[model samples]
Each structure stands twice: as C-alpha cells, then as structure tokens.
Target: MNVFVSEVRQLIDRHLPHYVQSLQAEPRLKEAMCYSLEAGGKRVRPLLLMAVLEAYGKPISIGLEAACAIEMVHTYSLIHDDLPAMDDDDYRRGQLTNHKMYDEATAILAGDALLTHSFGLIADAETTEMTAEIKVALISIFSKAIGAPGMVGGQLADMLAEKKSLTVDELAHIHRRKTGDLLTFSIVAGAYIAGVNKEDRLCLEQFGQELGLVFQIKDDILDVESDSETLGKPVGSDETNYKSTYPGLLGLDGAKKMLSYHHEQAKGYLHKLGLSDTILGEIADYLVERLH
Candidate 1:
C-alpha cells in the first residue's frame, strides 16, 4: 500500500507542473493555479481512483488521466472554498491560500481555469488509452459529480445551513452531496475504466460513500483535537463559521462512534468486493486513523 501510494503521488507530482505550465498565455493565472496544485497534499482522491484500477487488474495508465482530472476539480474547489466570501481561510497545506498569496480575482480565475482544463485533459486524445465512448462516459460522470446536484449543491446547502440548527439527517444530506458524491465518483470512475463487474462497482461506490463520512467525521474530530500547525489550517473554524458538523451534533464521543461505525461499514463493503485485505482495505483504515 505504501508503494502504491508513493507511486501515485509521484505520478501526480511529475505531471501536475506540466499541466500548469500549459497555461503560459496568462502567467499570473498559471502561477496561482500551480501554487495550489504544487502545494503538498495526501492526493487521496487520485490515489483511490488509481488503486481501484490496480486492484481490478487494469493498467494504471488507463486511469491516470481521469485521476488528474479529478484532482484538478478537487483543487479548484479548495481555491474557491478559501475565498473571503466562502470559508475565508487564509492558509492551506501550511501556506497562504491562492486568494491570500495572489488576489481574489486571480484565485477565482485560476480555479476556473483548472476546472475547465480538467475536462479538456480528459477529452484529449493523448490523455488516456480508453475508447471514445468510455471517455465520454467518464466526462459525463465527472461533470455531474461536480455540478449542481453533487458538490455544488452540497456547498450551497452547507453555506445556507450556517448559524441554523440542523438535524443529523440534514447534516448528512449536506455532506452526502458535498463530499460523498465526488469521492464516490473517484472510485467508480476507475471501476468504469477498468470495466469491473457491476456488482463490484456498486460495492466500491458504497465504500466511497462510507469512506467520505469517515473522512468528514475525522476532519471534524481533528479540528477539535489538532492544532493549527499540525492541521495546516485554523482549528475551530467550523465553530467560527457556525457550520454544522458531526461533532457539533453528535458530541465528541458520539462523533468518534460514528467514525468507527463508518470505518467498519467501509471495510465490510471491501470484503463484499473480495478486497478485504488489499491496499483498498489499508486505505480505509488509513483514512480513519490519519490526523490531518
């Protein structure tokens, strides 16, 4: 699993700079885009996509383009999320956010470039070895996952829910769209590329959903327990923003319990897919245990 993670991280690191450099027409925009893309991260979304491909006996090359595409979308979301009108965060991954390092307009334009360029990358003939039909399907999935009914809707709900009391179900609804949809797409996109059996694909989708919940719950717990230096962002920002969180609704102990429950559920889905002892299994564990 360590080797797999290392390989994917290296693959992304080597290629991401080239992608940013392609935007030479607007040097400042390219700089802002590259700044966040180059910033160190776990690259969990792309890793999950490639890992699913590897596990299904598909060549990792087949999914690398899609992985990059998804990472672009994820990074774009972070840039916008940190804007003054949004999360208003000053730092990300221990460095000034794009909006902070550059200007707000530059940051917004950089994000827009990343989001649009991702689709172009996916559609480019040189990007992947998949068929035209497969590429189209992947693009459709990618668009919908990040579009109104998915990540965008969730973000809108999250923003609207601020300073308002929410039921546990309502909070879950917000996250299921906001975070879960994209994570689910990451795994399922690989499955589609690999042409995995429908049953296994469904299992992976379930695992992604469970893993997303575990991720958000762990994040909330970390915000309470971790320091800013360790987290690379401010702690208690959720409180400051009056956003709904698992910990806030469930209490620290209840949130921890929920995390454990989802961890088990994610593992169970992997077991159902006959991947209980694979790197995907280890990833499930790692997601729950990771502090940042």
Candidate 2:
C-alpha cells in the first residue's frame, strides 16, 4: 500500500472514533450513531480526495478537514440509503445497517446529524493560509453536491424508478448525479485547494466524472457476479429491488466493456493532467481491480 494511503487511513480512523463520540445525544442514540459511523468499508471517496491532494503536492494538513467532511457526507448517505424508504437494505459492510441495528427514527436522526455536522467540520478547519474565497467556494461546491440538485435528486430518481424498467440514459443520469457528483467533487476540491489552474481543473473534473461512472458500473457488475461476502451487502440487491443499473440494462458483458472503456478514458485524462505520481496510477488500477 502507498504510504500516503496508509497515513490517510490512519488519520480518518483516528479522527472518526473521536468525532463519533462528540455526537451529543442520549446514551442509546449515541450508541446507534456510533454503530453505523464505525462500520468498516473501503473509504474510497475520501481517500480519492486525499490522494488527489498528495498527487498535487499539497500537505495532508490542508486536505484533512475536507477529507473527513467527505466521509461524513458519505456515511450520512449510506444511513439514509439503507432506510426502509430508500434501498431497504438490512445489511451494510457485512453487518446490520443503521435501521436494522437501531430504530428507524434513530437511524433517520443519525443520518440527519451527520449531514448537518459536515458543514461545521469544514467551517471549523484551521484555514488560515487558504483564502476566504477558496474556502467559501469549496463549501458551496460541497453543499450543492449533497443537496437536492445532486445526490438527493439522484436518489429520488432512483426511488421513482424502482420496480419499473428504466432506459439506459435514465440509469446513467441517476448514478452520475448520485455517485459521480460527489466523486467529481473530491477531485475538484483537492485540485482547488492545491491551486491548480482552471484548464487543468476542468480536465481533472472530467477525469473524476468518468472515474465515478466507471466505479458505479463496476459496482453493478459485481452485484451480479460476486457473493455477499465480497460485496459486504446482499448480492443482486439491485435486481432484488428491480432497480436499473448498467448490468440490469446492458447485460454483464456489455457492462464490463463499458467499464473498461471508461477506465481507459479516465487514464487518458489523467495523462493529460501532466502530473507524475505513483498514487494516481495505483488509484486508477485499484478502481478497475477492486472486488468491493
């Protein structure tokens, strides 16, 4: 593993434990919040942001607050997603999901708290060296990404499509907004804080979008081909929910082909960025190779 990856992982692990403890609540509610927040997963999104910063020669200190904020937003989404009203999943990361482990109201509140707390985390980060304009822009980008026009909108679209056949375009739109927006934000956020120029930022944004799409498509394919033990959630849940995905719409072989094409496209964009970094190459490879 890359040293940066290990360090970033440790940073997240260390901060998350204490961060969860700061969730002021009644004892039982506190436990419920801690349960899901502590659940293990790949931490791909936040790590991607941190890696982008490292690749651009920014100190981890500059990106630490943004990295944790990304995770907080991600965890909040997962909590709400597993609720009965959303994906209705009973398990996540190979354990009982928030709603399954706690009452529905507690799960809902926990998700809400995490989402609302993310902004405070960002605002409180010591950003003395960062210009006020840049910090405000970053906050705006993240806020919009998590709001109705972004993840929440995509989720609503997904819910509307459940049990009903959807066109390939529809599936792409949903996942692009649901997953791609935040993933794009990761790259853009890192690049912005690193002071990359506008043209390079545009290229990186495109790269991140393609990467995020590939990530989601591969996930759908794995849902069809991998067992629950590897996936950390029920395999075929998309099919179980009758939700549309790349695999559900295009067949396994077709989805794999799409993934390969997008993976290569993402690499092509990365090459255009002119940055020399082992982490970027390793990340691209890992995105294609990861089983979960």
**Which candidate has the highest lDDT of all?**
1
Q: What's the TM-score of each model vs. the native? A: 0.96, 0.95
lDDT by residue (1-292, candidate 2, tens digit) is 4676778888887886576677676777667766876798577777787777777877767877777888888888999988997788888888999988888999999888878777777777786645678778889999888788889898898888788888887888889889889989988888888888899989989989899888899889889999988888788887877778898788889999999999988988888886534486578778889888
Cα lDDT, model 1, residue 63 = 80
Could you tell me the C-alpha RMSD of candidate 1 in Å? 1.3
Question: RMSD for each model, in Å, please?
Answer: 1.3, 1.6
Local lDDT at 213 for model 2: 89
Residue lDDT tens for model 1, 111-169: 99999999987887364457788889888988888999899889888999999999988
Candidate 1: stretches off by over 4 Å: 125-129
Candidate 1 has its poorest 10 consecutive residues by lDDT at 122-131
Off by over 4 Å in 2: none
